[model samples]
Target: MGQLERATEATLARGARLVHAHPRTLASVVALSLACFGAAAYGIAQTAPDASDLPRRLVTEIVAHEDLPSQLEALAGHELQLYRSEQTRAGDGAESLLARMGLVDAEAAAFVRRDPLARKLIEGRAGKLVRAAATPAGQLEELTARYAPANADLAGTHFDRLSITRGADGRFTARIATVPLATSVRLGSGTIRSSLFAASDESGIPDAVAVQMAEAFSVDIDFHRELRRGDTFSVVYETLTADGEPITWNHAAGRMLAAEFVNKGEAYSAVWFKDESGRGGFYGLDGKSKRRAFLASPMEFSRVTSGFAMRMHPILNQWRAHKGVDYGAPSGTPVRAVAQGIVKFAGRQNGYGNVVEVEHGNGKSTLYAHLSRIDVRQGQRIDQGVRVGAVGATGWATGPHLHFEFKVHGEQVNPLAIAKSSEAIELSPAERQRFAGVAQQIRGQLDAALTVGATVAE
Candidate 1:
């Protein structure tokens, strides 16, 4: 029994010594075993009968190649004459339009002046592209022009195209038709570097679209004072094209479907919503109207020289409460109305210069002073953002600056405070539900745009 125990102990010690002597070899063996087991298990799990029943045996056959003649027909060659296009320049009259089109026909000129339809073709239409098709001898065959009238809704109607064609009998026939456009939604994002217009140009956004975006949020934010470097914006707007080509660069000038602007770390969003009555307006995600009772500032952009406070009057040379805030701007800068009101007084007032006072209901009145020109007349009803006058230093002693004041119940108040404190309109219950769906769709588009913008930035 003792000899057997000793022999077993010796055997265990010899095995341990062998493992310690060749640890690398032992590890390799274990690794190799694991690899083999894993391979076998994978092979067993992946094994399957051939689902496609096809022959495994190989067969060979020889085939002959046959040659055939070409079946393509030769195209007849002809000279390609492209229609020439030219933009009507400033001071362009009927003679200039005809001259640019390479047409010298006296009958065509007379037709333009005599016929009503022909007169509509060139009446007051400037800076628009006009295309003409002419013969090799400079004889005008046809003239075409497509344009949208001033303030026309692009979504509801396409551009009007007027085609004046000369028949083989030498008689001119004029016809007006709608040039259809293919509508599409485009997403764009830009970061403000120097100015909004400059940044928009760099981001490939049209100037008209940028202007609309500013107007969309003009009620809450003052673009001139609030815009900062690195402020970013993303918009999902509509674009129009004709024949798969862009018809106009300002295709998105009509309406903005969705817009987002992050200014000073605050994000403002607006989505367009149209009710059953076909009335549309920009609204927030929570279904609140973006339009307020008044805009943030009378001017689109400016710098405030003096805030509402008690200070020494430059003209009076005495200390007095400056009831109105002063905004320094260039002469002839357009001044907009704060809200819908009636022009209570328009003309020169004591120490106010050429001032315009708009009286809103509920004993609220707004005063715009120091104007070189007044566009609105007394007792005239005016809407918000309407240009009332121009900036000038008229009454009060100062440079070209606008003196603006707000009053409640015949007492003067700070215009900036009232503008910021006014409540925005809200949507109805039924409209809220509809706006929710619209907002969801806009959110999806905005998300996709953010992703694309991030990728582009990277």
Candidate 2:
């Protein structure tokens, strides 16, 4: 007998009174629902048309058949040809290469070994793309090998096609032809899990493309020192193909068209562009050139072994101020000029070993020391990125490494600092409009590249 019980009873009584007051209206709602249900039930109860009463139609056509014996004879007369493709191995010879492709004709193998043009397949560099056609009976019908052009200068634009075919007289003939290479645009993206090279490899990016990415962002990020685990990159690049097959030669990798690299939380972008005068370079979307007065590193990619600081010298075994930066790399790795300049000195120094010194104007100079071989000579004018020498340990020191130093007015300073503080090339006012259009197109491609990379990573 609480107040709550009284309120509940009053609410129920009010609802009952309302229902009684609207009885006719409620009856109409119930009757309408019943009519709808009756209609649905009647539709469900209706039977389908009787199968015997349904209309039916029949149609027939004649098909000619060949006699079994004639079919068998025709199949027997047709020689089954099998096609197989493989990459040439380092030590592959005529017999071994053909055997791997399921070809067993001794005559074809003999011609490959004796013919001057045919022997080129097994010679020179390995990894050439080879395709062969053979009969079911193991007779070689034809073979074609595509590799880098014979002329080194033409490698980027052409490829050498070697064909060995069986003639009607049962003799094998070999011919070599230089064919122009085809170009295709390709997109790639990767996240830096461990290193740039590792991420690029996981994304199926070519090594050359990865190197180009590093060079593209070299001004903003020191790949060797500033690379982080979560850094990511997207790229649009050109690929050279021989007869629709991507070339495997190192020299055949085409130039990078555009790239976007996100290091840490900041993103940097670059697109390759050529001006009216045909002078080409990488520029940002804002129309600023990425090329500076000098490159951060003399080598494309290498770790800094020693910095410009006071430390125990590896050779002297005593604490001394190291004026130059030491980069650890494999022996014979190409060393490039840091900036465009004339070679002031290119010869052996007492402690520096085989060194190349280039004097940039305005009292600025750079030195590359401990080279295994010098490619440039004194008084030779070389541009930035021109190969000057190869890494070596020729001085009074340890293993193979390149010693790099930057000087301003005969005083040694940190090369990295000088490279970073150098002036950047800017685009002309006339070129900005044309560059904006190219930048817009490249931005979309880079976004697509990022999507592709994320899918691959997953």
Candidate 3:
């Protein structure tokens, strides 16, 4: 029929002829195959026995049932305590807060309103974690609230505990104590679809951690302008908790331990390291300090309302050169000093509104205009991140915004360019060896973070 079929048939014919020519040999081969199959059958029959031939045994035991009357009596004697937790909200009064926690004790509410220590629950800032133990009848038995301590210096390391308990005399007693906070490491990863905050929110990262991430990479990336869609980041940070519950106030996020940001397909990494002097800062895995002479932006994160370019002035309605970048944020937003410097001028000027001028060494000076209020006075030394003022619409501004300007020898220059060109400090030789170990550990953490990001992307 075809060349292939004809070839196959010829081969088969040759094979048949060979078989016929070696009839005795073929018979011997068949006998050996039969013998091997018989041996295999016999071995299988000997190894496997019938189910009925295998050993069999019957076992039985009696299970005793508990007496129902005795069980009911035990349960009746057990105290039925209900536990509930709620967060304090703004405008929450004693009655409202107790009601939210499913508590309905008039005496408890009256004590909360009258007692000085219990009044602290509703006073001051809100968002305190409140846990209450109540009876089956919805009467509050004990109440405890945890929040940031009154002392700002101890806010990061301790929390204020306000506890109220019902005494044997049917009276409520309240006490306040400061307790040390616990620290825990956390890992998070996200892909940028819109903004860093949005990504961080989707990844369940706290706002404080996101702010720290932005600040850690402030010198390398201008979060206001450089963030791109599809960019990804992985972060390792410390979270402070009170009695195992995460704290919510006082910027309770501990410190950013390590982070890796892939912006525009280029990856940047940072790790926190403390020197023997107990001074700590974020450094690249290569041991290069991330701190620069100047930060790219005065605010942690904000959108640019105006750039350094010529545009129609909102007040003048005519084309004029805009010397500084305008950051659009709510009024009273703290404006930080971009570099450590001495306050040269901290007063209002014509068309500049309330302003603070800082004289950084090397003929470099920076100005923050349209400030609602100035915190630093003239001739005061301020650190790079120290708050100089707050955003405002004072002077010639139309809306609330921070107008930031950088000057080189009395001439205005682009602040972003100047910050990017600033030199970065390198680790000392003595610290390099220790830093290498830290970097190695951080590198593994980053790799794990990358895997987490990839999983989230999927």
| Per-model tally of clashing residue pairs | 0, 0, 0
Clash number for model 1?
0
The lDDT for every candidate, in the order shown, is 0.80, 0.90, 0.92
lDDT of 1 by residue, 1-458 (tens): 69999999999999999999999999999999999999999999778666586558778998865433322222223444657787766676666678777777677877877887777766764655578887767667888876664446653446667788899899999987766667777888889998888887887776767877887787667765678999988888876654344455344443578888888899999998887688777887878888778766788666778778998888778999989888999999999998999999999986778999999899999999989999999999999889999999888646899999999999999886787788887887887888898899999998887676777778
* Model 2 alpha-carbon drift over 4 Å, by segment: 1-81, 250-252
Clashing pairs in 1: none
lDDT of 2 by residue, 54-106 (tens): 99899999999999999999998997778999999999998999889888888
CA error at residue 140 for candidate 2, angstroms: 1.6
Q: State how far residue 103 of model 1 sits from its true place (Å).
A: 10
Worst 10 residues of 1 by lDDT: 68-77
How does each model score on TM-score? 0.66, 0.80, 0.80
Alpha carbon lDDT of residue 372, candidate 1?
A: 94
lDDT of 3 by residue, 310-384 (tens): 989999999999999999999999999999999999999999999999999999999999999999999999998
Q: Estimate candidate 3's RMSD in Å.
A: 9.4
Model 3 TM: 0.80
The model with the greater lDDT, 2 or 3, is 3
Error (Å) of candidate 3 at residue 448 is: 3.6
User: Candidate 3: misplaced stretches above 4 Å?
Assistant: 1-80, 252-254, 450-458
